[model samples]
Target: MRQWTTGRERAWRLLLIAALAAPAVCFADGDAVTAKAKTSLNIVVGSREARPGKEVSVPVTLQTNGLKPAVLKMTIRFNPAYVSYVEEEDGAAAVGADKVVTAFELPSGSLNVVVAGFNDNAMNDGLLFNVVFYVSNAAPQGTIVPLTCPSGDGVLSAADPLAARLDVTATAGSIEIICKGPPAPNPVAGWFDAQEGAGLTWGESAGAEAYQIYRSEMNDPATAEAVTDWLPSTARQYVDASILANLQDYCRLYYWVRARNAEECASDPGGPVDFVINEIPDAPSGLTATRGHSDGVLLMWNGVPNGAEYRVYRSNNNDPATRQPVSEWMPATFSFMDTTTPAAQYGIAAGCSGRLLLDFFQYTYWVAARHTNGCESDLSEPAQGFRGLPESEAAGVLPERGDLTAWASICVLLMLAHRAWKTRKA
Candidate 1:
């Protein structure tokens, strides 16, 4: 074994010199004693999350890998703007060491830590010391303060027989200062599409830099968690497209929003707004279409539950895709008086050479259910009906129709009335 006892125990400087002067010693395995390793000095402050004016302990840990260190000295730097040093004890100076010395360079915001021992067990793996610090009361929230440990000059050595020199790599850590801000307001769940989920919106906070939305199956805020990490300040709206529509009011969801400021403080949640969902209405069934005595077709269907509106579709042929809504969305009712507007009347008959009055043409009709949220159901069973006419031969309704003489004049006036009818009911 390379003799370390021969050299009189001296200070760390002397030991370093001796270690440098010692010839490369080969062990029985023919391996030299000099084994270089990357050691680390880390600042671990239990939790990086901290509020202003709070005391936090920063543990200076050493990772020598498997190498036993005999002498370790380094400078631990901290940001004075966020934290200030607190303790000066041995454990706080140099942990698990026989001789401990620490130099406080306060103005420079650094702590020079030194520890050495002759016994091989001087410094094992794990923490080397602690630098207790109190978070500055004035520290702004969201500020990430750095705790860096830079390698001091020629300060680390192994406990090997030759006191092999080790390549020490120091790592840095951090402390975060957190604060609070004003809450968001007027959180609302505006709209919902069975396919697109819910649209959530909220009023802005005075100085908020960001926002977050929370959702839960239960009405309580405690059960709710953030749907997103955080949103930019400009984002006052979010669509929770992950939600499924409650067909039978199967389940209800609640939403809330919180604002965050530049200081990283999150305001109190704004609301427990109930999420609005557009449940898909059931298709209207049991449909029947019969020729009217005068100008339109009388159509009837089973009323749909939760159906805020209904749409009537008619096709000249059997193709479902070819069928189109004969009228704009209508109120939820079991029966509808569907009139054949001049637009449908002016079109030439399919088998006939000229335009027929459509008094005897058979049309396939269907009824669909629509929810207030715009979710629509499949079309109902088809029923056949003979010709019908416009409620009033208004000229404006048939603008797109071929304008020929008498029909042209009628089509012109009906357009305005038709648009107005569409704006209200079909």
Candidate 2:
């Protein structure tokens, strides 16, 4: 299961506030769905602390467990008296939404924060998004503003949002009105980079001296280790260039960062965002190369399930690099007819000076498949083709018409002279 977390990073909050505060996210009013949902998701909201009149960003994280939902809408309830829903981003887009696609504040002090995205099969890794709140200045200290992720429909205490039809278990979160905390770096957003591996980017933390990155095979921080030395406070991103060394197709990678002071570290760490690499096509199978009519060679190979194209390679004299592809990147073909086999180079080297040479020539060949992603499969087993011997010589690639004519003419003159000599002797 992959879990994404959120936090109160000043950089994201400032940008988010600026984007939505000027013009609050607005969407057409719609009815809320309280339908019992069935999904494989577990949503968790982490707790945060802020002083009265201060703002806080609570991470809204979830475990996908590899189930990419077609759509998700999470409706939340918050206390307006204790804290106000600050600038919200409309999330018709998906997780990582700064503002929801639509927002509804009920007269009963409940808020419907609907966040939704469509992904029927594919999935990416990272924190879903964060919920921001502005604590009322008049609110008393030590008050906890609950950001409750309540269940909708049925006796099911919690379920996926209406129409989502996914089984969802949500754990609610809150913010305590207190003034004791160190400024920490914001949660990171990560994505896969084909060239360099997983890429991580975070916002500048408040009063941070420097930053350091950590990585782990699992999502747990306890299993993580710092992969980089202290980076300058101005550094906001890092790329896991070493990931390709251990990466497998479609494998997942995890990373996170933390803020530091001159003599201390933040009380808490930022998020451990994850990313999934892409998958390459499998190697082709069941390759066969046999002698075609005369000296031509026929090649056949089984198609790969994900293969987009196939390549052919031939070698004479057993050198793998000798033969170039008679045809390259052939699409939708399982076989090729190599009429130019007994390559001219090999033929010439095998004493092909006479019109009909009883020379022996051998050719070896291999085949491979290519994926749409430009990844090539391993070459198939070598198949050999022969150009000499009794069977192959008769059908051997013919030489020029004039190659043996001069020799034939000389033979006729010698025969005439021998006959005349015999007559004279008689």
The Cα RMSD in angstroms, rounded to one decimal, for candidate 2 relative to the true structure is: 24.3
| TM-score, prediction 1 | 0.33
* Model 1 worst lDDT window (10 residues): 23-32
Q: Per-residue error at 236 for model 2, in Å?
A: 40
Give the alpha-carbon lDDT of every model: 0.61, 0.58
Q: Which regions in candidate 1 have their CA more than 4 angstroms from the true location?
A: 1-47, 88-103, 155-172, 179-426
Residue 55 in model 2: shift from native, Å?
A: 1.6
Tell me the deviation in Å of residue 27 in model 2.
26
Q: Write the per-residue lDDT of candidate 2 for residues 1-426, one digit (tens) a residue.
A: 223223544344334433432222211111223332223344445577766766787654434434343344566666788777765532222444232245566665565545555333322223445667788777765787666655453221223342333322343346677744346567688778677777888888777888888888667887889888988988998887877775654344567788876544342568879764644456677777653234466678889877889988887756765768868699868998777655322122122232333243557888888777666666777887643222344343443222233433455566678779999999
Q: What is the lDDT of residue 236 in candidate 1?
A: 74
Give the clash total for candidate 1. Answer: 14
Error (Å) of candidate 1 at residue 305 is 42
lDDT (Cα, tens digit) per residue for candidate 1, span 1-426:
322322343244233322432211110011123443322222222335667777766554443324455565556577777788787445522455464646576576776656565575656644455567788878866887776655424524433442433232344346667666766655454666677777877887889888988888666887888989888889878888766544445345678888887766678778877743536688888999864223567788998888888888989888888988887888867787666632334454332333434334678899998887777777899998763335355244333223234554454456666678889994
